[model samples]
Target: MKLTRRLFVGASAASAASLSAPMVMGQARPRVVVVGGGSGGATAARYIAKDSQGAIDVTLVEPSREYYTCYFSNLYLGGFRELDSLAHGYGTLASEYGINVVHDWAVGVDREARTVSLAGGATLPYDRLILSPGIDFVDGAVPGWDLSAQDVMPHAYKAGTQTALLKAQVQAMPEGGVFAMVAPPNPYRCPPGPYERVSMVAHMLKANNPTAKILIVDPKESFSKQGLFEEGWQKHYTGMIDRIGPDFGATNVEVRPDTMEVLIDGVAEKVDVCNVIPAQKAGRICELAGITDGNWAPVIPHTMQSRIDENIHVLGDASAQGDMPKSGFSANSQAKVAAMAVRGALTGSQVFPARFSNTCWSLIATDDGVKVGASYEATDEKIASVEGFVSQTGEDAALRKQTYEESIGWYNGIVADMFG
Candidate 1:
């Protein structure tokens, strides 16, 4: 189902007709505009398309022709998965799911008008809007690091061009050269992602260049799944990775791309490759729409609707929901509940009480895996943890295999649910 503009227009018109027919019969389906098409937005689109059964018109505004999953990206870097495997086309959303997928960046939201303005000069009017635009990196947090330096050092966090750039650098690096990774502080997207990426890169370096080194500069003293990752690095990469916590005098580093040098504690060092995952906040649209305060948009739990704007709902890594880590899985789960809430709001129906779940798997060494997850519920305007766990310590061979298998299963299910 490759959806061209013609197909999209036809589906949009058909959906509109279905919803409008109710008006002639003295009833009408509501309209919804989704501001993104990533994991969270896409899942919301899917559920809305299904649960509404053409009674809701959904328009998904996104800039990309395809959506990429960050879950299996580490495997893609480790030479175990291909880029296409993690990529998903929006054909299903446009054609089969009856979602109007628009390939344009949403620029503004007129809450009073109930409309979203896109960069392409399109104004989409909606009865309710669901926003899931992902996080944007905080520029200048590293003093000299900014968008101009992205060519030399890509965050690779968004899972497309940046991912390819980092992969090519690793493949082309000289033997035994240093690869520096600056991990972002907490309250960031995918807590275990950066470390898992380092582990996978180290896995590649071990087989290709045994003497190569990886320097992980961190501002925090502890990280998610730290103990498991450290043990796995010791057993597998064996001193190839140097862990630098804030205590290691790396707190005030500045990056200079012209010379490919990073100044750590006033001392400059050159590296063959650099992956700088900087601090992050809600995407700019959130702030522009008046939904965000400082870093993220405050939202009512269970509903995910903006506390300040009743007509708009925010989810994914963009919302300031307590007790929820910013992972793809969490985003996907929130999307479902958000879609339901948006529909209920627009149609004057009941918004069911919802609980959210998330699990993130980190590949520490080749074939070794670890994870952390939680189930959350809303209580008195705040989200509280229900149940979850970090991966068990002292893994058995059988458990390791099971974890790996479960990781793969999660990847497949999530991608399928998002695209199919």
Candidate 2:
């Protein structure tokens, strides 16, 4: 219905005639295969397919039929939103944008051949490949925390099975029971997520179990929106929340799932509910492809093209780009830049300089919210910040309410832009 100046300029500069008309006239199209249909992959697939206008064959490979976004998953836990509202289908990606949506996981990547091997045994060849498979948990980073133990201690970090598992456990907890959450170390997916989750779940507990308490065991001494979240927790939960940072003996905690207990500094405590968000790395697909080091794949800042393999680009939690946190907004923004770069590369054009934006919102209660954000631009060769942005800290009632409402609007607009 409307267009921003940036979008208009991007559209004009990336017209079909400018990028793909030659191939169409020659009766051939360059193939671009994208792995992972989350924020990064979906946005790139849609934009490139739309811009190419039949001159670029876009194939998207993902395992899930429907995507569940983690951005507002906390609202679902608080009973403020339905899960169906967060689930988006890829039909529009196929029918409207002409993207070939393949519901399958990519098991192997052949960089030499420029082909991606699917778990279903199908091979999709591409001139350029984009991978945004998200994060994978580092198993057993915390002693006694593993796959089977996840049944008793759900992470709920990845937003699918984990989300459902945690919700069920929270619903079953008795009134006045303890709900303990172990926040992961820094540089984890959705930096403000675990705190937001505690807030939403605490809201539910306050309504149904006024005596319930939330124990947050965090690896770091401080976190994003710490003051804002603490203020909201105090205002709404009446000090029912307790936070133990690393300095306060959080790192010394160990999980004992067999007994449904967590030990802080060797003092075992049983809880009715337990959620452990462990350390994470690039999703297994990147590891299988041998494109990542430690927990992330290194890539060029503006282009997002893999430094290990120039033809491949990685985004989302899977990439270790400088100074960028692993959040949905970051992934989505990087996807746009990566897509433009891919198109430019395919058509022998120059990649433009780009800026990116990210904002994370956390609800402290039904009508109160906290947030942090930043506007970033490329600096010479690295991604750097252009402005400082954060929500009002320390007990502002009206601003909190405004941020809560704004969070809803932001969620609606982001999902629509990605899937609609």
Q: lDDT per prediction? A: 0.84, 0.84
lDDT of 2 at 40: 92
- Stretches off by above 4 angstroms in model 2 are 1-27
Error of 2 at 81 (Å): 0.4
User: lDDT tens string, model 2, 1-420?
Assistant: 588653453355346545444453343567889999989999999878776665577899989999999889888899998888889999988867767899998999888988899989999988889999998889777888987787789888877777888988998899889999988997899988898899889988888888998999888978888888887787788878998888778999899888888888888888999999999999998888788987889888978988899989998899988777899999999999998998887765557888899988888887777788888986646678788788776646788789889988988888877886
Residue pairs in collision within model 1: 22-27
Candidate 2 backbone collisions, by pair:
none
Cand. 2 Cα-lDDT: 0.84
| Model 2: how far residue 108 lies from native, Å | 0.7
What's the residue-level lDDT of 234 in candidate 1? 87
Candidate 1 lDDT, tens digit per residue, 190-218? Answer: 99998889989998888898888999989
RMSD of each: 3.2, 5.4
